[model samples]
Target: MIKHNIGLTSAEIGGLWEAFFQETMSVCLLKYFLHHIKDEEIKIVLTKALDFSHLNIKKIKEIYSKENIPLPDGFSEKDIDLSAPPLFNEPFALSYVYIMSRMGMINYAFITANIARSDILSFFTNALAQVTELYTDATTMMLSKGIYDRPPKISYPKKIEYIQKKSYISGFIGQKRTLNAVELTEIFFNIERNYFSILFCLGLIQVVKDKEIKNFIKDGKRISEKQINFFNEILQKEDFLGIISVSMEVTDSTISPFSDKLVMSLFHFLNSIDITLIGHALSMSMRADLSTFYSKVIGEILLYAESGFSIMVNRGWLEKPPQATNRKNLESR
Candidate 1:
């Protein structure tokens, strides 16, 4: 093990802090899924995911103890109901793991890159590898089950070509050029994620009793639908079919399987991810129309996320992460 005498940097603390909550939340979700899951293949994958989450939580706690940092009170057994009937079908559970593993891979890789402390770096490096394997596992299972939604395929170019006309980038007026491969890939992934988001909101809205929370989730579902229509319309104009995952489906169970706080926090997390993804799509888009669309939707998502954040704060659900000491306040005192 590499030893570091220096303390954790703010970035490292922030990364670990975020990871702790994420993993704890995962533990609750995976346990609930395990209770209702019948498919052995998907069960095995979820079990592995739960084990990884447990290991991550354990490691994070160790690091926190060594640093004399207080542990975060993330989601736990109280947040989930194992006795409640399945709120989502088996296929949806598998798809959830697949999508979440992909997100975990992205997050772990990003955190690992930003970490400088050797021990923390090693921890996240291992985490990235574990989540990558989980992603591969979930993907393989989806492919074998014929549930994986493949992106649209385009004909290969005959020769290396360069854009010579300014109209190539022009999308606001005249005939807009078809989406490039990069842009198509981004839009395709975003649509898949939004589909999951819609299903998530639909499931929660069915069981959550709080009127305000239910309305918030209803709005989230509507926003996802609008975003999906926008992306699908763009694809339709190009004669390419819009991507939709047929494997995902929510059950009619009205029993609340999770606390309102957990559901709201999960929604906030997903919305934040959506904003990050849309921002990236905006940067990669060369066409003004695509960029403009992404920017517009990003603003909508930010507003929705902010509302959810306020709810979490008001309900005492949001955990405060490590922060710099208030030196100015010390002088004032």
Candidate 2:
């Protein structure tokens, strides 16, 4: 056991703080979903996800209690209403778990690499394994149910060749080359994520009670649409078919099943994910036009995320994360 005499390092503190908030939010969401989900396959996935989330929260609480750090006021029972009606259908729920599990895997991998505390690293390591299984199961179920959107297939290359010309990356002035498989894959996956975001915002906008929150959701939907158009147009120009909309998955339920705070928090999280995905796309995109477009899109998403954060702060809904001690101020005092 780690000595309680030694306090947590900054990296440990930050990682635990972030994990606490994220897992807490996941717990609330999973609980709500568990209440409404009827499909056996989907319910099983949700149950497992909820279990993992609770376990993570408990582990973090133990660490906090040992270290004498105040626990974060993450989402709790008040943040959700178990009696609320179902907001998403079975397929949507499964797809959500699949996508979130994928993101969770990425997060846990990062957390596992960034911290020094062996205990915290071990916790996240297990978390990653759990989510990896969840993703596998969810994807298998989705494919069986014919709900999974498989990426477009391309013809196999008969021969491999090296790029001998400097013009391969040029898209601004001369004949732009057809999108390679890597670029196409990135663009397609990015647009596919935006479609999910747009549908999520569309559904939430129909039920959110607060006008400010509603408008924010609307703004998010608009941005998703704009990004969708931007990326889809690129595919269109290349004569490649684009992804179909998942809006049909959302129902016409006008009842608010989630608290406005929960909804806003989800929006904030999604916007952050969007920025990350865009940055990844920007790095992988070789053509100048795609690179420039991804850069601009990232800027737009950053502005939107900032506005959402301001709203969260003004409403007293933002929970501050752990920070380093202000040594200079403490010394002056």
Candidate 3:
């Protein structure tokens, strides 16, 4: 039903549709965070995030209106209770903002990279800037609050050197080479992200009341812990310290601050991103063992994603995405 001259492309529509739904969920979660957050500094960061989410939702609505497309029924105030007890402590909430902001930057960058339309491109560029600032502010706050776990410091190279041996990429035999900087960066980044996922899952498991969903989240936590230890063992083998855990940052809370749908959606999103990142790491990995391990882990995560989708579908929580017309059905008719 779109016009040829000025109508939005499918890519633009998909990007905006996904963004609108995510921003709506972000608004609801941030609103709850703002309500229960006691630290003024962290509160300020959450407020900024909430403001951006609200603005994105408004802009997306405008685009839909122009295109004569119906808006998605994303999360709203009805999906959250502001008066509920705090499910996550301030430090955990701060970490949540930091992690979510980082993901937001990745998403906006991806959307902007493929965009063609002038308005859509500009919208995502502005969104990228906002999320970058939000990430900066959240990380600064986490550091000031002493909740950030920085990567292990490596010594400066005595001098720039080029690869001189094939062993640099070998892993299936004798005299395997030590980890390179690129591989180490990817491993550490993965470990740190999975660490965050563990804590996030732990908090969610404690509060989510649905037995099935709670068990699914527990599987997520277990997977994260498994991955965390596997990656950490890699660094520890080199006598190098790894990023420590932040699971203790989560407080004991049985009350749910977010709806089950929001919690699962967040889990689904995080796991999906992890799959993408793991694929990148696998592609860059030179060691045969590491590459094989990443491939197996990816399969595991895909299964996990399938389970999450099932939960969402059974509960009638999953939103239907736009799809191409079924020409076969038309022909049969």
Candidate 4:
């Protein structure tokens, strides 16, 4: 979705808004996806939706450039607070997707209005229409799956006050809690499960294509194995399940709608995602259990993240963020 807030020019705020939305929404999208989706075909469709949103991040920047707007570095992927529990559970995932789709529509409509002179606006408008359809389909799918959760309605007049007071606590404090060994096991497997599920779907990203996704998945699958192994060791004697049996089970359809350059960019993005996943897993593991098991797991994931970082650099996809002030000097070499 696009933004229409009357604060700044497309150049000044476009990248920031895009980054802000994509970075935050992407994590939530991934979480709800892991909870609700099981079919490979369905996962593919969702992955395509994710690709659209991700690519729009770039398009927003390009649109800003076209409008002579100076895009601000508003935030990074870290801006999103995914550790907070989702607003709803699995039953609400589809509705959440729908809500996000509507948000995308609003965003794109605003972009179209602001940049009526740009060709990309036309493309975004087309995208907005399709996203509406995707939301419709996703909602229907959720209904068919018997898992659609709608926004809550007011049941009591005092509920507003209750929310005003407690929403802060619940949003910040109540959402995330340390899981027991059993809960911890579920959490790790759940992330692993979604990892492949999204990869299977990303095979359809029009810009990035399947081979890039497959290669990145190849690297990711091994890291996930390592992370699970580390966790299983942590859960020793607890009869906790780690990376037991899993499968991608993707269909044979292989066609890409994106350019190769974009595909490479996305693969790089996935690599960053892999490294971050390990960091989060390790961080949570440490917080939940200060035992040797957790420490060892962190060490293992640290190595894995470093390895992915090496690969990311080797692929020439290491995006020098703002902190890398000396990169210009290094690049000149």
Off by over 4 Å in 2: 1-6, 172-174, 246-248
Model 2 reaches what TM-score against the true structure?
0.94
Residue runs of model 4 more than 4 Å from their true location after superposition: 1-217, 229-248, 253-264, 271-333
Cα lDDT of model 2 by residue, 1-333, tens digit: 776655567777887887787888888888877887888878988998999898888888888898788998988899888876677776788778888888788777877888766777788788889999999999899888887777777889999899887778884475798888888888887877878888788788888888888898898888889878988887888787867755447777888777787888887877777787778888887888889888888888889889899999998999887767799999999
lDDT of each: 0.89, 0.82, 0.84, 0.48
Taking all chains together, each candidate's TM-score versus the true structure is 0.97, 0.94, 0.94, 0.39
TM-score of predicted model 1? 0.97
Q: After superposition, how far is residue 5 of candidate 3 from its true place, in Å?
A: 3.0
Best by TM-score: 1
Worst 10 residues of 3 by lDDT: 167-176
> Is candidate 2 or 4 superior in TM-score?
2
Clashes of each: 0, 0, 0, 11
TM-score of 3: 0.94
Residue 22 of model 1, lDDT score: 88
TM-score rank order: 1, 2, 3, 4
RMSD, one per candidate, in order: 1.6, 2.0, 2.5, 13.3
Candidate 1: misplaced stretches above 4 Å? 1-4
lDDT of 1: 0.89
lDDT of 4 at 11: 34
